[model samples]
Target: MIVFLCVRFLVFSFVWPFIGGWREMYAANDAIPLFINMDYMKDPRYFAISFRRFFKNFLNNEDLRPGIYELRFSKPEKVCVLENSVLSSERTLDVIAYAPRDLATENGVSFEKEIYVRGSAAIGQNNDLRALVCDGDVSLAKNTVLRRWLDAEGNISAGEGCNLGVSLTSGKECLVAAGCVFRRLYGAPVKAGTSRKKSFALAARDDEERVFPPPPLGAKERQLEEIWPYSDTRFSVITPNRLWVGANSRILGHIKTYGNLNVDDNVLITGNVFAEGDIVIGQFCKILGDIFAQGSVSIGEGSQVGRPGKIKSVVGNQTVFLSSGAAVYGYVTTEGDGRVL
Candidate 1:
């Protein structure tokens, strides 16, 4: 029995490092554009090549060359939409846009680069915002359409219907307006995956082991939140500070926060809500999931905690209060005190 256990342990230690390294390699290479079909490039009206010429003449070895660089002029009007838009930092290699009005680019934007939009930025309505990095704060006006993975070094504030395609990483906070959409938001580095079943199976096992063996002091294991595959739109949102999900917004993913969480009225959260501080769910809200709070939790009147008889609601280490006319479909558990008034 001892020999068997020892062998298994040695095998895991050896295999895990290789698996993790391979996954990182795959994620880094996944965004590379394999081919650019000439048929798609034929439309000069829709696909402009002004930047290619500009960069050839202006950019030297001293300037950073980006995978996708643009400095365009609007036809007939001759309005320079992308002006003086040089790679300000050699370290930056990402998609960036600077325009006063609508700027449409053919979207194959990838490679996890920093994106800066002085004015509102958009791709064609049909394009997706895939694999971009923001080394600083990202501020966008209303109704910005997006569908991609983002890594931000600062806060992210977007207006209504702004789509976070797959995953988001924020160094500080994430504030979204009403009716916005998101997939996953994380504050830490999350491991990328290739499949859903393997990821979830590993996640379930991790949950079971979390109660048994405490992790070694200084040894790193994947977080429960990091097991989900990158392809799965049903991912988790993680942050270390206050998480403010706006009114009437809809999230089709899980939320994990390290500080206070304020979810406004008429919002529909389709996954679990986990927070370290006080949590307030506003009136007329529908959470088709579980609530786990480290501090007090108060659900306002006309709010529903979970789908009818599906999942139980949990509150930790503080008071759990439910106001009048609020209906919790499943069992409610609180670590300190639970009251309904």
Candidate 2:
């Protein structure tokens, strides 16, 4: 009996997280339905990826979007918030779910049972709660930095010459290309120096001291404290050694590939003519173009694949989009089959 109990406990510990998240995710029809602008771009394909993520996150399948406030969540009972509706806000965000649940996607499957939107639409702000904010104007380039506190926020960033939803922290740097988005959901606090009377710039390799440099007039190219262009891409091509896209980033255009592709979340692709390497695109990727993978391709979540995003078909070997939320819109005549997400 003792040995049996030990074995049972061990198994429970190892498998409980995934199993529990799965059951809780798919428990009902009103679990976690994603909310996105269906009218933005491609029709069903867009929803396919977003919907899959909504369910998975609700079911504990994946991470939450970066800039989320009261991500409406409920207890054991199925709850919902319909469109053309509003939700009231909670101070300090009194809503947080620690319970384990199953994570899965229902796709277009039917649902039966109970789901009640218990509370009225709530919307408000909490001081102690975390918030996501852009470093500067939304249209600014990668060299720009918004102000935040490291004590209260975290930063995500993208390469230079890119439109990002990510954050960039002080004394640190990230390299991203143009037209990329860095969406940061969690924020950190900004560091404060004793020189509250004026602004000072920190040295390149040192974080403890400040250096005096020629002051820039309002017209002298907005001088950033920790920002400087390191390279020039005007005469050459902008190519990252590796490419990775997060789930929440709203992206378009065909990214040229010579290495690895790791895509998660709802990635909107206009498609590419040629891509050579191991490819992994999660959730929904509206292919308005064609994708030719010279290596393995793995698709995950409830993403819509092929066609619309690619413009043609997907041809490759060792490819797979194995997930309850997996969907492909393009033509797949490849010989690859792996788990989706």
TM-score of each: 0.32, 0.28
Using TM-score as the measure, the top candidate is 1
* TM-score for candidate 2, residues paired by index: 0.28
Runs of candidate 2 exceeding 4 Å displacement? 1-240, 306-311, 336-341
Across residues 1-341, which tens digit of lDDT does each residue of candidate 2 receive?
A: 99999989988888876886777778855676688867687321232234334544664644333232344434343322233222232211223221121111111111122111212111122112121122221112233322221111112232233322122221111222332222221111111111112111111112213222322222221111111122111111113444565554433334545666676555554335244677776554433345567776654544444322122344556553333333333234345332212
Runs off by more than 4 Å, candidate 1? 1-235
After superposition on all C-alphas, the RMSD of every candidate to the true structure, in Å, is 21.5, 23.2
lDDT for predicted candidate 2 compared with the true structure:
0.33
Deviation (Å) of 303 in candidate 1:
0.5
Give the least accurate 10-residue stretch of model 2, judged by summed lDDT: 187-196
lDDT of 1 at 158: 49
lDDT of 1 by residue, 13-76 (tens): 8886688678868888565768877666522112112332333343343333323444333422
